[model samples]
Target chain A: MKTRDLGSAAALAILGLLAAGLAGCAPGFDHLEIKIDTLPPLAVSVDPTNVELPVGIAVGITATPFDTSGDKMDSDVVLNLVPKNQKVLAVETSLDDRSFVLFGVGPGTTSISVQVDHESRTDIPATVKLQPME
Target chain B: MIRKLLLLLPAAGLLVLTGCPVTDASTGELSNGRFAYLCVDSSDPTCDGIVGKAVIPDLLAVGGAFDLEYAGDSGAGLVQVQPASDVMISSTAGTFAFRIPGIAAMLAKNNGGVVADFVHLRGVDVDHLDVLGESLAESIKTLEMTTGVAAALAVSPRDRLDARLGGALAYTWASSDPSIVAVNMASARNSVILAGIAAGTATVEVSLRSGLKMAVLVTVKQGVPMTTSSSSGAGGSSSSGSGSGSGSGTTTTGAGGAGGGK
Candidate 1:
């Protein structure tokens, strides 16, 4: 009976160690926020603002993510973009999904929702205007 | 006449043969060293009118094709690029195209000897051009230039990250109307000389062999006295870019006074 009690205690300790090892593998991010790195000319009033694109022209958008701790995360973060109005704007995602090329399809207003590691930011405004003939 | 001529020819031959070394004309042999030359074929549209020479000054973009012409006395010679991955010579017959982005030296050789002309190959993986006097979107609406003056336009080849690529020969400068503005390659890699010929508007385009290109609209006005302060101001404006972006078109500062928004 004493041996059985000792064996049970040893098994419990082993399980606790296994649980602690798995806990150490968790991701460090408390939360993720969208960060815009580049913007087109005359498209935004300032940095970190809405986009205004010229029709038939494209604007490159580079979106990196920062965690709640304000530390910029690298490749591990998953990024996804969904445009509310595909007729006005179309999003072309890069191989890593962190970078995007937003093309103005027509003259209209739309919005893009960016999701990073399951945390999403919605309603990023985009306006497309007609380009004057040269 | 024939008999006399024949007798004279034998006497002349005997006198020459007395000290001259004998050589077999029938046998395919070269007394001197072998030689070869390379030229660009008309297959490359960018170099279509350009006659192939020992060295090509133009830069070729990856996936751009250029025909290679080999002329040599060496029977069945071989043509290959050093660092073979930079270009693909699908046929030794006489054509080649770039496969990757890098510099490679093309060599043509065989049992006789290597060709005298060695082609210096340059390739780039370019997506867009950062024209020094263009907008943030990399487009120039209108550029005004003074007649009888030169505008230094700097253009850079950028990859996806907007990082600049090297090798000046990889870019080609062309003027739509040379009468208005003539395109001249500057000594510096990124800068090009747009010399105003007359009062008119022309398009100056820079391109890679791969067909990736950018253009600037240039309007030449009547010449002024060209004051030192104006010249300095133009140079300063080109250096200080009017557009947005870190170090974008910075090389084009000399173009500022030569061209401004009109």
Candidate 2:
């Protein structure tokens, strides 16, 4: 009778552990949140594909990166913008790093290129000129 | 049953350990980025022994150029500049130019993101000028040179104590009288060679693109200068001795000699 009692106890412990193991295997909401960040986006684009401004003035612009399913990525990703002719126009970074400021330095024309994580996103044609006399 | 429980306990611990995968995003060609400046010209003495001295970014001037090296595991990719318009990088590896006067960060990026970065402050005005092979006192406002000899003069940008490339290409040198002294660009853009054309006085002026100017008076002599000495009085001395043993004649002779000397 003692041996039989030990066998029943062992069987109960095994069942309880298996049930716990199955519970742990079920995916949690937190796992889904992690998946959202780890997924890579497909393409990045900048608003206002072309820009024109007067010298000595600055304007802010935004960049949007989307995924394969045409969904916009809201995660904090590294972005860079470079001007082809710095003497004509310059790109400055704001506090949030999500957006940029373009300053007109001289009366000329150049193109600005956007980069996301070592990949070329898009090129923006920018023109800077003197304001017309009032 | 006890043995089975022990085996199950080990398996449970193993499962917990393998549940989460460790992900290090900086693995492979994305780790340990470093930067350095390689000296391409010998005229800039600051480049001497600068191979490993570039642990920190140094000051630069507008229109100045430098050779920079971005060291890292690029993983089959090339490094490029990002985000600043005050500086420019060239297709040739490690060549950079300062375009404007401002504090800028030259970010070096590759396929793995920003692997290295260098921050530098650029200035437009020069603080001091140095005449090679001459003392600071001699080169401050006036410089003396021999006819047919050339003196190399270099300009230092304000607040840049050690940088030798002080926007050398942006400096314009002119002589008040080219007949007295001629100014020409030295091998290093930041320096100029003043050749004494004739024995006369002339002003050598250096101007920056931003409109700041500095001038030095240069007096060219025909040959080496002669240092003259002041005239000194002639030195004279006299001594006289007389025998004490009844030498009346000798005593009289000594007195006469003393009177003559006086």
TM-score of each: 0.29, 0.43
Q: In candidate 1, residue B8 scores what lDDT?
A: 100
Which regions of candidate 2 deviate over 4 angstroms? A1-134, B1-31, B39-45, B48-57, B73-77, B81-95, B112-139, B160-168, B224-262
TM-score computed on alpha carbons, candidate 1: 0.29
Candidate 1, B116-168: lDDT as tens digits: 22234455566787677522234354678875577777665666566544322
Encode model 2's per-residue lDDT on A1-134: one tens digit a residue: 99999999999999999999996664321100101111111111224467675544444445555544455554554566778998888765532335455556667899877665545667778887654432
| lDDT by candidate, in order shown | 0.52, 0.50
Give the clashing residue pairs of candidate 1, or none: B40-B52, B59-B169, B59-B170, B234-B257, B238-B253, B239-B253
Model 1, B92: alpha-carbon shift in Å?
Answer: 38
Best by DockQ: 2
Q: Candidates' DockQ values? A: 0.01, 0.03
Residues A19-95, candidate 1, lDDT per residue (tens digit)?
99986664454433434433333243212347676653444445666655567766866766667887777665532
> Model 2, range B1-262, lDDT digits (tens) per residue?
9999998998899998987543211121112344555444533334432322233234555555555445554332576644233322222344455554444334455555532332333333244444433432233677888744688776544533534443223567788866556777766655688876455678988776767667888997654322442221000001111222333233334334323433
**Model 2 chain A — which ten-residue stretch has the worst lDDT?**
A31-40
Interface RMSD of 2: 12.4
The TM-score that candidate 2 achieves is: 0.43
